[model samples]
Target: MLGRKLNDRYEIQALVGEGATAAVYRGLDLRLQRTVGIKLLLPYVDSTTRQRFQREAFSAAQLNHPNIMGIYDVGEEKDQNFLIVEYVEGEPLYSFIPSPPQVVAEYGRQICLALDYAHQKNVIHRDIKPANIHITPSGQVKIMDFGLAITPDSKRLTAMGRIIGTPAYLSPEQAQGLKLDYRTDLYSLGIVLYELATGVLPFDADDIGVLLLQQVKKTPKPPSELAPEIPPALEAVILKALEKEPQNRFTTAGEMAAALQIVLDGGADTRTTIQPAAAEPESAPLSAPAEAPHTGPIRVVLADDHRILRTSLAMFLDVNDDINVVGEADNGDQALEVVRDQQPDVLLLDLNMPGLGGLDILPQLRSNWPDVKVLVLTGRDEDVYIMRALRAGAHGYVLKTIGEDALVQAVRDVAQGNLVLGHGVAERVVQGFVGRAEVTSNVLTTLEHAILTGIAAGQTNDEIAQRLKLDPQIVGEELIELLDRMGTASRTEAALIALRRGWVALEDLHNIS
Candidate 1:
């Protein structure tokens, strides 16, 4: 059919693309001397297929949008049926898959606007896939092929068990051959964006039968899991539009476009459920750097060995919308990797992890990723542990026993540069440092009591010995034995232990000094 003239005015130059129903050819309009795209129906198609082919021209002609392909003419001669359309220059949208979140959202917004315009005119482009969309060099999105389009009053031409659109992009209702509305187009658009953002389909199978069934039954993996770079906000919009029930999807294409707008505006964390924290704060975050303030939802990465607890925390925090669990880790090594890759604003770390314990990596995190604030969330409230973590550069300390609401608030507090201490942590710090005035020493020998009091009051062994009228060597030897017997690692730690365990009184230290 190359170099053939249709209707004596348009000359077909070459076949540009082919599909199951028709072939698109590069054509020249002799009357206007302009290049145009000519879509010709294959002669082998039955009458019903021919009617659908003619319907594409009529359906697409009704819509006028920069993102949509324009239909110019339609005719039939000598059993050849053809339509002329604006010749757009670019590869199919599929070629640009696995793009950055911004690129995906940009094209997605354009496609949504086009679909909304078509839907407003009562036309539903049932086939909304990457292959049916085009991207030009100038970055314009052109939606093509309204072959499977339908109007509210159009006839139902589908046969039972026969899927009308690409299985991978089909909405669950379309997969089940159920009646469709404009939302069906939204569902298909979701699949296209999911693929473009992640470079993979949400649902796919080798067999057509299995593929359609998967679309109806399989819940897709979240796009962010495949492409960690995808912003949480964009992923939320994609997943919402891919809902199994049409009613669960975005109510309109325009609404989905607005959601994408948030991601494009650099507020990649702004979501549907919760608004971003106010940029202007009543008080500046204590830990905020001097250069610029962080905006958007507080991006957090949780590192805990407890899978159930991690999942529960993720679900809880995600509901807030202003706090996204951008990344998660079940061990310390994974924590480091996630922080390096995700660069989250907050790292909720556990002290008792299996490998590379929290303390093991706390100082490393402090020096290597100083910008990321560390919050130790553990059950160890002992003063030794608290001081060690805080001294190791932790910004806050929260116990696992904290209420869910308090935990959320603690995260927000830490993000804003305020230090957080779990309910009893502060009291424990005080009790473990300042000896109880009324308590008397009873659990230690006289020499041990004197030495412990000296250590608590920040005195050295030589000073304790001189005050106690004992040899300096004797004080040193006794301290070594005490350290072993009490199972304490250092003099400071022993001091905290004596005070915390209520083994010594404040009066004991005054007697030695």
Candidate 2:
């Protein structure tokens, strides 16, 4: 791929970056006789990731700013999809941690300006980390990778209950898979600033589960404690940005930039005072679980036939203060009894159990225990099983291959009344269903038809939500799941499907507006 010429123009020269979904390389534009950055999609990614890659181009192309990376073109040569961006010569921000307040504030102010520009244009950079930031030779900051950015009308990629963003930098809302706004980016930037002020992340753990919870509620040790040079004013700005609630934080990126600018103008750090938080633990928070403002931990009951698997999962969940594994049952009857007695907030049910089979008891549990959010765990990812579980009223479906953090979060999400699909369950089930829909004459619901038409008409999430008289956030989330089921790589694909299936009339699409 290093010497390949794409679109008969850009010739790949050298690979510079590689990630799970895409690889960025230095390329030469044969047409313009200039160097360009080419982000080529990796071959193994699914249609969803490919769509996201295209979405990055659409999302970022709307903004033109010095601090933001420039988008040149998006192309697809045969099966290879690639994005052309400005070739940046710089160092990543991760290498320069523990910088002084002046340097931190200076870099932060530039980031803030870029974010301000993007936010004004309705682009939310969901994944903001030090690695995504760069500093050129002359000290110009360049923010790269808009792959996770979201617009008001963009289709959300989290099919099922998948949460977005890096766990360490996730905002409370993002962690919970709730509606996000411009403030979410601000929260992530706050984390970057905090890490720059002190060499350590405010929240760090080998376990993703513990780290996610810390981001949501755990208060951080004062930056001054980690590095005594951070002034009171600078610390105040950083902490405010890290506020638990968006309402408590800066309303906009521009507002946060102004605060950072004040710190930059304050001259130099001339104080030498330290607080009691200097002795803070690296991972644990100062606030006790009992004293925290949030509600009690989510009560959960695990029901799996295998003892070892059930026991290990129980232990993993029980370790987190936000989750409690109240009981375990290895058989269907035992699960019924335990759930009846414990009345757990969530029931992690295994389908292949003895006596009353997991499938057999699903309807009974749904009828009797309406309050219990049932989540099915299975080793099989057959489409039939997923449909059966969900149709029987299970709130969440996950395979045994689910990661530790994802499993814990699934339980938490179910407890909060959210639907979850994990471990390729969504893509497999959605693809299977869509594949058979034409033959089976599977009818789409009215809302589903309307949404498909919205996409066909090229309307944004906000536009669709407005026309349907629903919340834009709800529409955005539903779009992600819908796209996954449609097996579409982009809006154009979704729109084409709707047109071919006759679910959306060519005229009706544009009629919405």
TM-score of each: 0.51, 0.56
Best by TM-score: 2
Query: How much RMSD separates candidate 1 from the native structure?
Result: 24.5
Sliding window of 10 residues with minimal summed lDDT for model 1 = 281-290
lDDT string for model 1 (442-469, tens) is 4565567778888999988788878876
Clashes of each: 1, 1
Model 2 clash number = 1
Candidate 2's TM-score: 0.56
Considering every candidate listed, which one attains the maximal lDDT?
A: 2
Model 2 clash pairs?
153-461
* Model 2 agreement with the true structure over 174-222: per-residue lDDT tens digits: 7656688999898899999999999889988643444556777689889
